[model samples]
Target: MTKSSGADPRKTDVKVSLIGGHRLAGATLHERTVTASLIGGADIDLTDVGIPDGAELRITKLSLIGGVSLRVPRNVRVDVRGLRLGGVKDDGPSEPGGPTVRIDAWGLVGGVSIRRA
Candidate 1:
């Protein structure tokens, strides 16, 4: 678990894994998170975090040959976009209005799954 922060530590850059797996929980996250992986995976649960109303929480995923499983809170909109050579699934909420989570992901060969928690 390697972490770096922006001007605000709440808005963080989380390196999930290099060749294994990592999990994120039990913390107060902010509006944005940047994550990456290579030949491994990451499980990110954002259900317990605080996202401002109508604000968009950006999750930028840079991964290759690995998987990223994301669990978001309820009543939020999830938008996933990227270029990938594998599967990307989003089983999140579809309600209109409220907080939004934008996932920008890019990978050569892997999978990304986003679900509600």
Candidate 2:
């Protein structure tokens, strides 16, 4: 995927955006709530994901234009079967079920994956 010309996405300066060939990766995410958007050949590498005891972390939307590789914790579950036109969604490591990761994806012509961490 093409890298974004923007600033460091990991910085707080970037609120909620991962596009224009950008990239974002969170080392240890503990926020109970979260949102993400990807497009224009961008990439969001969420290495480690987390959530509260009985809460949920929602990835509002992941409109991939290039690709996305997210490594979720063994605790939380991934359900990124939101919306699609013509592309692919790979919620890697088929766990039984856990916390819901409601992902509204739009892989018009790109790739998306949620692997184990």
Candidate 3:
């Protein structure tokens, strides 16, 4: 329900708080150079959201109903924990070299795909 961003250039952090069963689609975060967190079960659609190099994206304690896709750059790290990818479509590359994507979806049922361009 709340979203906050840091002001300092050295601190590039974006925090998103979502309630359970909420639907979030077409959300994009760009150019920031820090970490992102999405908490709770929400339908999130992250298509064409460019994550910068060396940035960290963390999705924890949530169930992704609609799922999330990343057009991520090289050297970025993504961590997903307790996430459920339902009705997800993989439209990117299968190789895992652009970013160090770490997924810990213990309750995932759908599917997750990563592509490089």
Candidate 4:
């Protein structure tokens, strides 16, 4: 959240939390975003955000013993992949034709939950 130094609520990156939780929501995100946590967790919400047609939004995650919960709008396609020792629960893509969101989640002893907003 430190990189979002404007009144537009646009976020390019988020600070990692070690022993607490971080919530990033209601912001216009960049094409690429990164989030990580050591012993905490993060909650990301992207609702009513506009993404260009055929554009791709990439989100990379790194978690050690934490988890991440992501909520996306219903008009985008989601592609999730990674290497993890935990688990991932994806609700799959929303619509057939829309913007693409690629998520790369790499973690150990944590989980990722993705669902519609």
Candidate 5:
């Protein structure tokens, strides 16, 4: 599907991928919305999401079988809720309050981890 998200990178999709990653350290999503959908059996890694002030990033879907690892900049505000049929979810460091990163995660046999970068 195509979108007119305007300058912002459109929805990111990784299907049957062996590896996947995304960085947003010095990037701009200002006034833009970014969403990522991870579906399949690949292990995905997202780094520095919404760091140093960015836009609203929503992980609308995550149904990967290999799981996902999200490394966010410490002190950023994060809202995450993961449901696992059989796995675990790790919380990162204390949130000092910064940018916002929202996520709705789910897994069958995989897990999700939030690490402080």
Candidate 6:
């Protein structure tokens, strides 16, 4: 329901934290690269976390209990761990270049599709 942005602006690393009955929808994060963590909870529904074209976003640890959807451009590398993506829908086009995007999910990503572009 409420949003806030950090003061750091280097496009190298970013951190997002959501807690306690906060739901985020249709939000976009561009040109800023996140290095190692994407944490979510049951009270948070990150249905729209989009990265710009040619931006590098790495999620070393992802803990999603409610839901999280990431819309990434083609050729961007993605890594996920301990994600529960059982409620995500496949509604995007496939990215080219032979799966240049890589995903590593350890928890439960049931119906989510990591398509290209």
The candidate that wins on TM-score is 4
lDDT (10s digit) by residue, model 2, range 1-117: 122235643322223566555454544232322344465533445444444445554444445554445566766666665555544445455455555555455556655566666
Superposed by TM-score, candidate 3 places the C-alpha of residue 8 at a distance from the truth, in angstroms, of 7.1
* Per-residue alpha-carbon lDDT of candidate 3 for residues 32-95, written as tens digits (9 for 90 to 100): 3222234333334333455444444444323433233444333444554444645444443344
**Whole-model lDDT values for every prediction:** 0.70, 0.49, 0.39, 0.72, 0.48, 0.36
The number of clashing residue pairs in each candidate reads 0, 1, 3, 0, 0, 3
Best by lDDT: 4
* Global fold similarity of model 1 (TM-score): 0.75
lDDT of model 2 at position 45: 51
The candidate, 1 or 4, that scores higher on TM-score is 4
The reply for model 2, stretches above 4 Å from the true place, is: 1-19, 27-42, 45-49, 62-64, 85-97
Give per-residue CA lDDT, model 4, range 62-113, as digits (tens). 7777677888888878787887776778786587888887878777766788
Rank all candidate structures by their lDDT, best first, as comma-separated numbers: 4, 1, 2, 5, 3, 6
Per-residue CA lDDT of model 1 for 14-54, tens digit only, reads 66767766666626444566767776666778787666677
Model 4 residue 1 distance off true place after TM-score fit, in angstroms: 13
Residue 9 CA displacement from its true place in model 6, Å: 16
Between prediction 3 and prediction 5, which has the larger TM-score? 5
Per-model TM-score on C-alpha atoms: 0.75, 0.53, 0.36, 0.76, 0.53, 0.34
| Ranked candidates (TM-score, high to low) | 4, 1, 2, 5, 3, 6
lDDT of 5 by residue, 14-113 (tens): 3233344333332433322233334443232335343445444555334545455556667656576667554445565556556666655565655556
Model 3: lDDT to the true structure: 0.39
Off by over 4 Å in 4: 1-14, 26-28
Name the weakest run of 10 consecutive residues (lDDT summed) in model 3. Answer: 29-38
Give per-residue lDDT, candidate 4, residue 53. Answer: 69
lDDT of candidate 6 over 1-117, digit per residue (tens): 122247644433334454321232324322332322233422212233443444443332233432334444454444444455464454554454322223333333333344334
Model 3 RMSD in angstroms: 7.1
Q: Report how far off residue 65 is in candidate 4 (Å).
A: 1.1
